[model samples]
Structure formats: C-alpha cells, structure tokens
Target: MELLHKFSFRLLPPVTFNFNHTRLASLYLSTRFPVSGPAFSDPGPLFTSRRPLSSSVVSKAGWFLGLGERKKTSLPEIVKAGDPVLHEPAKEVDPGEIGSERIQNIIADMVRVMRMAPGVGLAAPQIGIPLQIIVLEDTTEYISYAPKEEIKAQDRRPFDLLLF
Candidate 1:
C-alpha cells in the first residue's frame, strides 16, 4: 500500500458503522486508511442493506408513504399464475422499431401500469406482452430514510420508461 501511495495513489478509508435498523442491528465495524483527496473513485457502502419488509407486516392498511390511503389503484391484468405464454420466450424487440409511435405507446402504458402495481420492476412477459421490453421504477422513493451523504451520492438514476 505504501509503495503505491509513494507514486501519489491514494486509498480511501473503509466504512465504519454501528447500525441498528430492524433485522440488521448487530453489525459494527471500524476501519481507516488516512489518505485524503480523491484518487480512487469508489464511494463504498453509503447505505447498509436490511431485510425487506414482509408483506404480512406491511398489510393493506399499513403506511403508504405516510398517507395511509387504502384505495387500491387498478393494475393491468397480470399474466395468470400458469399461463403457457409465460413459459414461451418473449420476442426480442427490434432495434429499428424502438422509436416508433406504436412501440412508444406500449412503453408508456407499461410504465403507467407498472406504477399502479407499485412494483420496482416489470418484464414485458409479466404483462402478457410477448416482447423483451422491461420497465423499472425509480429507486429514490425507497431511499428517503438513507443518510444525507448517501442520498447525495446515491446516483438517483432515472427509470427508463422502456428497455429491451
């Protein structure tokens, strides 16, 4: 490590933390390497991973973004549990047809319905579209409870309305 640093390479300090979140309270680590200004470009572990909230725990009446709204939004008919179409491979989206109006409309509808389903992701096959397109939701909504620095560094990526 010292040999690399003699040529001006700097190693960032490792994370030190004492987390106490549900299902993740026992971890405690302390580590450091005293190199200051940025050289290496890895911002490691801003947030700790925890077990997901169980559906049974977050029942229908549970907090929905603190609003406590109970009215369920409608979702497009999800492909049923044992549909043959689901087993069949989805068709690969044609690269040339990507920007076409029909494809755009399908993508828009996929995103809109995915939001109402409140899912973080949806594959085209899941909605009975035998195409390879997929849609994903923004992750920022789930990171509100993360640390300020973590949020700032969280790379709030935009959800592509559609992807193949």
Candidate 2:
C-alpha cells in the first residue's frame, strides 16, 4: 500500500502593461548604465534581450505602484447569518440627498471604517442605515501575492445602485 498526501501550488499570472516605443526607450535608457553618444544607435536585432529586460523593469514598477496588490486582512462583513437586512430590500437614495456634504462625509467615514476593519464589502444596513448605498473593496484576487505598496494603491469604483 502506498500513502499519498495532497499538495498544490498556486501560480501567479504574469503582469503586463501597455508601453509604447518612446516610453520603452526612456525606461531602458534610465535603468541601464548611461552611455555616451546617441544611445541605441547601432540598434542590434529587434530580437535582442531588451524586451525581457524592459518587461522586468516594468513589472518592478507595477509592484512598486501597487497596481495589482491585495490588502493584508480578511475582514468580511459581520452580518450575522440570520440578520433581516440580508433579506430586506435596501432603501432608495433621494436624488437631492445623494450629493449633500453629509452624505459625502458618511461615504468618507464608511471608507475609513472599511479600511480599519479591512473588510472587502459593506452595506448601509450593516452600518445602521437602510439606504441602498454600498461601499466595497475587493482585494481577494490580489491579496496573497501582491506587495504591500501595491495593495495600498488599489482603487475602488461603484456600480449600479439597488433600490427597494
């Protein structure tokens, strides 16, 4: 009889970014040792190792900029399993109320709390409101391997609103 143990390895997808010729040239020039005379003058075959090197440079830049990083904590919303808010329809936001400074402040505070709790998503009811507004930060996909700086630079955008 043979004994076996389960094992798995997660592979990260390659990071890619759009860069034009001039930008690539600039990056290559900046990172490589300064050379006198016109640089890249006798440009060797276009198939030189330049492409891979440039890719690595850009990958490092992306990592530094937190382009695809994830947050550190796994703070899911705290709604209890039997909370009624889960089943109840969310309230609609009045158009006039949407742009008020108070509403904006609330949104800001919500973002702060979310960050502190390290939660990915939060509903108004969870925070004691019945409004349809929701703020979420989805960093699950990038959390495991993304650098800290990259995770901090992550951005969030809202989608369509759900109304009761």
Candidate 3:
C-alpha cells in the first residue's frame, strides 16, 4: 500500500472529479481535443476538434514522457521526492507545441519510465519536465499482483493507457 501511494496518479486535478457517471476517465486522451488549459474548474467546452486525430501526433508508446537525455538509460530518472519541481505547479503545455518532436519524445520517454517503475501513473515533473502532462495505466496485469483487499479499498481497475 505504501508503494501504491507513492506511484499512483501524480497529476490529478486539484478539484475532485466524480467519475461514477462516465467511463471517459480511463480512456486515452488525444491532442486533437481542445483543452481548457490547466484550470479544469471552468464548466466549458474542453474538446472542440471535429476531425479524427492523426496517428503520428499521438504516441504509439501508450503513455507520457519527459524531455532531456540520459546516456545511462533510455528513460530519464524519476525525480526524487523532495525536488522543488514536485512541489511547484507546472506550466500548462502550449497548445501549439503539442505536436512538436520534443513533446513527442518526452511522452515516449515518460511511457518507458512509467512502465519501468511499474507504476500506475506518472507526471512530467516526475521525469524532470515541468509541464502539466501526465500518463496513466491501470492494467489487469498490475491488478493481479496486488492483494484483493487493497484493490477493493482503492477501487483500482484495469484501464487503458491514459495520457494528456
């Protein structure tokens, strides 16, 4: 349970969300959907795209990543617990920069690192990127390894790779 607390969703909105009504919370989010910045408080249109998202812009790797390169490993190291970036609010990603190569690589790297950590979710700042981006996966495989009581207590379930 301590491990789960450490590696659960790292960038949930400050406001509590009621997901009992919809399954969208577990779905993969695409950039084509218009975003309302970091403030999810506004009860307005979040996604306005009318066309299907391009496959190239979306990561095939299935999660988020951070920027910067480390020769020692393919994925960036997870920032330690006391890092300032972890406590500070990260800047929202610029809408125009979503499709850039750098962001794409970051997403890819984040996915790799998250899987390596065997965590359910990760934030960009976890990998040293100060952007308001996050990736999450709650797979059946992960669930199988946990105690039934803990899983029931946490309401954890298998969800697709979710990135935004």
The lDDT values for all models are 0.67, 0.61, 0.80
Error of 1 at 39 (Å): 86
Better of 2 and 3 by lDDT: 3
**Could you give the candidate ranking by lDDT, starting with the highest?**
3, 1, 2
What TM-score would every model get versus the actual structure? Answer: 0.43, 0.35, 0.54
Best by TM-score: 3
Cα lDDT, model 2, residue 143? 67
Which candidate leads the pack in lDDT? 3
lDDT of 3 by residue, 109-134 (tens): 99889999999999999988999999
- TM-score-superior candidate, 2 or 3: 3
Q: Which runs of model 1 end up more than 4 angstroms from their true locations?
A: 1-75, 143-162
Q: lDDT: which is higher, 1 or 2?
A: 1
Worst 10 residues of 1 by lDDT: 25-34
Q: How much is 71 displaced in model 2, in angstroms? A: 28
Model 1: per-residue Cα lDDT over 1-164, one tens digit each:
77866544334555554455742443322233335635335667655559665454464554455454456655556788788779999898889999999788778778877777766677877878888888876666655656778767866554544354
RMSD to the hidden true structure, all candidates: 23.3, 23.3, 29.3
Candidate 2 local Cα displacement, residue 50, angstroms: 76
Clashes of 1: 0
